[model samples]
Target: MCDSVAIIGAGNIGRAIAEGLVAAGSYAPAEVHVTRRRVDRLADLAERGFRVSADNPGVVAACDTVLVAVQPQALDAVLTGIAPRVEAGRHLLVSVVSGASIAAIRRHVGPDVPIVRAMPNTAVALRESMTCLAAEAAHAGALDRVAELFRAVGATLVIDEEHMVPATALCACGVAFFPRAVRAACQGGIEIGFHPEEALRMAAQTALGAAALVRDRGRHPEREIDSVTTPRGCTIAGLNEMEHRGLFLRFHQGDHDLRREGGVAVRR
Candidate 1:
């Protein structure tokens, strides 16, 4: 039911949100507007029929919803620049910058404008993200719309804004880190005498299939794991080896230590 959406940055997260919003048919690509200094990187969006601009103010002034997607350090400056151009009840600000809070945005952008704090990981680009949503104190429905908007691209959950930083610490950053863990698992498969390409495919597909088991089976993952884990069978033997190496437990529970060695960002 949105007339237009403007994204204040053309970074990966911004692109994902814009693409999802437009692709979901809530609005057309022509109704989507994007701005960034790097004009070249916007070619894909431009080709998809979005209005690409280098002027954030021009874009922000024209849209019903505006997404602030700059880096955390740049958020204040971007807010300051766009504050005056945005009038009360005309634009609702949706922020995706990590670690920044809505109270801070209200202090910088004035009190009347509705504000939403949106946190989504890089998986958004693939339409498989898990996004967290929050709104300025007492500004209801703002958060719901934001959550629904993100649902077009991926799954979403609503939680207190105070939880966002830790949620970000756990998931947003972990999402990037999770892939490296997957790659490491694939490498381990290769070291165990499986051909590299075959091992990678098998590892990736196994992970995918395992996840689907939870979705398709409508039960906990361990239940599915237990289903195939017969007493002392080849699967159990392999399971025993994996358990001995801690790989089985670590890989599934999103283990912290195994993740740290793989370059997981635990904060910020």
Candidate 2:
């Protein structure tokens, strides 16, 4: 969708995005530019056919799309640095920094510039991330185009800006949440007398297969659960124990709060 994109920070998330863009062939190698205050971090992108520099204004002025990938705390300084060079209708600024709301960014850049607020997690590197987007004063085409850019990496959802914060906590933060559950599953492996590595492989594969079941069959999750839980089988016994411990309710409750804390710039 974009011939070139300028990334403000070449850090982990920013690098993932650049790599995603290149891998998906949406942006050519020379057309993608990445800028960072630290020169060393820019080398990786430089090697990948991307334009690299420490000059924010230059990159912002040169690219078709400007992606603000700075840390939450650094947003003010970063945005302030390039605000002078940004001319209305000249740049499309997309903020992938979490916890920062569009209203906040609008206040910094004014209302004329098209600002897009996004919540994309680390899983983007694998092209398996779930991303949510919200725009301030833009049309359906703008959102869809942004969605297409994000879809180059993984799945993208256009959601109300109000839900962006919780989406950050649940989906973005939730990417890290899955690992803890897998770790607990590994502990279960040890108790069953299997080597940690062996048990981890089995447990993780089972979970992977379950995910495939959801995507391939589009079966209601309950239907799959019923198929797995035999009459008083081990799966049911384990599930009953998890339910007793408040684990089931806990996950849902987390989702509720994640969605509810939508507007605050918690990333700050």
**Which numbered prediction scores highest in TM-score against the true structure?**
2
Q: Which stretch of 10 consecutive residues in model 1 shows the poorest summed lDDT?
A: 258-267
Write model 2 residue lDDT over 37-144, tens digit each, in one string: 887867766786789999998988887689999988899999898888777777778999877888788777787888888788877877877899998555555677
TM-score of 2: 0.88
Clashes of each: 0, 2
Q: How far off is residue 127 in model 2, in Å?
A: 1.1
lDDT score of model 1? 0.80
User: What's the residue-level lDDT of 234 in candidate 2?
Assistant: 94
Cα TM-score per model: 0.85, 0.88
Cα lDDT tens digits, model 1, 61-125, are: 88888889988778888888888888877778898887777889888878888999888887776
lDDT of 1 at 208: 76
lDDT (C-alpha) at residue 105 in model 1: 88
Candidate 1, residue 38: the lDDT equals: 90
Report the error of model 1 at residue 179, Å: 1.7
Kindly report which residue stretches of model 1 are placed more than 4 angstroms away from their true locations once superposed: 189-197, 216-218, 237-268
